[model samples]
Target: MEYYSVDASGYSVKPRGVALPRSVGDVADVVRWAAQNRTPVTARGAGTGLAGGALGDGIILDTSRMDRVRYLDGVVSAGPGARLGAVARLLSGYGRILGPNPSVGPYCSVGGMVATNASGSLSLGYGSIIDNLESVTLVDGRGDVVELPSNRHYSDIISGICRRAGPFPDTTKNSCGYRLDAVPSPDMSHRVVAASEGTLGVVVGARLRTHPAPRRRALAVMRYADARSAAADCPRILECGPVSLEVVGPGIMEGYGGSCVLFAEFHDSVPERGGPDHADRVCGDVRRAAGVRPVMIREGIDRWLAGRNAALSRSLGMTGDRAPSIIEDATVPLERLPDLFDVIRELGERTGSTPVYYGHAGSGNIHVRTPADSRVTEWYLCEVMALGGTITGEHGDGMGRTGFVRRQYGEQNHMLFGLLKDAFDPHHILNPGKILPA
Candidate 1:
């Protein structure tokens, strides 16, 4: 029970029962039973979610047993129980890759990625789950089996409700309350379900779009004296088309001879025989190229990438008692990267909490760790929203950011989310009190 109670966020909730379903039919039976008894059902993956999306007070549906990966045309269909690493390994054999990857990597589950619209370092060139998802199979709160995209009647019904939603934030990544605005004219259920955080239904399986693996790649490490200057130069650097552009804060990268360093990579369609590759210029910052130590080998690449993935867990450990602060995953538009860095600095000064800044620089999604109260962090959120940003990106508005979603999307959108909620789970027993008011 303790194992099911907590997630990476440090948030905990005791579920009534833990169900390990081995098949889709078992999952459906559990959902139906929960629906009949008026008990909430929370679909859990590897429990690697940082926002407490999988922790709730009812039934915990552990999808680990049903993990299976199958290839179908341009997409890979997998059970929600499938681990992200297993899917990646399966696709590696075919020279294909999942478009949106969570930095959590192997620990994250396919269902959890879809549940949070997860993205990673290369999300700039690829996209979030909203773009790569093909379809999903789910069991709503009411115990009804539903396959979105295949069920047009309910799709139109939910679309009618979602039509009244408010405008979305003007940023690259968002995982706030019910992204109704993402639903297309004909209603793309897969997109709507991606960031809903299990409020609408329990994800059983998903078909995700895949991309062909790049033939050759080059990586360059760019150092900047000032963090903001490093961010400001991102626009020009992006012009050079780096498939992956990620920032590393001070102390995060040692002996790099700078306060901050950016990892940039470019890919080629075919293997390089010899001569100059796309990573030659370092975005024309020739002085920066003096430290052009590239990660041409597998060991260096894996070691450095490990540091990037460990940011969140490391921050949580370093913060002591003030570990689980709310100033996390504040994403702004690429043009406003400088502004975000400035705001994070101000937040550190005001709250007296250590601020760590690093993320998908190309997408302006910076993860800030400030040891402050949620109420105090609201100030940063307002500033980002004013600059056309999102309060939470990739990390869903679970226990941490649920209170701020109202202001992020306006009250109209919240009302629409309620209407759509009724269409799927009338009893509100599916992941109750998540992405919505309790």
Candidate 2:
């Protein structure tokens, strides 16, 4: 029970009980019991989510024990319990790789990735997990086991609600509520469930498309005097065709205080590298990205990569429980990224919270964690929505941002979300109080 509560984001909810099912049949049995008893069911994976998607007060469905992997030609069939890193290791033997590799690293579960539509630094080159998803097998709220796309009956049921759905966001990634866009398209049943966060059903298995891993790789580091400078140059950097382009405060890298740095990597080979006229830059490997400073190549480079992944953890640690707002991971259009940076800085001044910023710049997905009040989240969401961005880029809306779903998509679209929730889980017995406004 201790392990069943709280996610990495520091949000905790004591569940009534936990159910660790060994097979899909067991999962269905538990969900059926919950449905009949009017109890909530929360599906969980590796618990690596930055949002509190896995925390709830009812029956916690733990799938970590269902870890299993199988090969399936162009795609791979994985139990919702399968560890993503383990799956990646297996695929590497076949010269393949999972498309959406979250910076949360290899320890996250496959189900969790699909659950949150996980995207990482490399997502700039590849899309989120939703983009690579092929199909899914799940147990509906009533405990009926079902497979998607292959299960046209369930698809038709979901499609009916989607045909009357409202507008969808124009952003690159969205994990706030039920994915209605996936409906209306018969083949997109998996996409709809992939990011639903278990509101619709309990995931049993998933089929994911794999791609050839890059044989050669190089990382480039460019230093800008400030975030604005780095943000201003992001557009030109994207033109270079690097696999990823990210921005981090100097604090993440070693001994660099008050400096803004951009880390870009190329998968095939090092592209022609250049930045601002006075930009002190390196574009060979990790160390070269640091202007070939006196840091050790292998060790320094490894630390640099680790630092980027640790951005969320670092900000969380800095809060010391005093920060009012833990808001992170928002996506705007590429052209508006510079303006986004300016707004965050202003937001920081207004809130009296230091915003630790970092993320995939090419796609305009950045994480900003500050210690402000709920108003900060509201202001940020309103601002991003005004710019045609999303409240979350990779992290799903759990306890943190679910209340803003209505304003994020407006009343009509928000109502459609409720309709889809009923379409899949009429009793609202699965993952209740998540992705839905009270």
318 Cα displacement, candidate 2 (Å): 3.5
Clashing pairs in 2: 325-372
User: What are the runs in model 1 whose C-alpha is more than 4 Å off?
Assistant: 270-276, 281-299
Q: Model 1's lDDT to the true fold? A: 0.79
The window of 10 residues in a row where model 1 has the poorest summed lDDT is 290-299
In the order shown, the candidates' Cα RMSDs to the true structure are 2.9, 4.4
- What's the C-alpha lDDT at position 117 in model 2? 86
Candidates' TM-scores?
Answer: 0.92, 0.90
List clashing residue pairs in candidate 1.
none
True-vs-predicted CA distance for residue 276, candidate 1, Å:
7.4
Predicted structure with the largest lDDT when compared to the true one = 1
The local lDDT score (0 to 100) that residue 154 gets in candidate 1 is 79
How many collisions between residues are there in candidate 1? 0
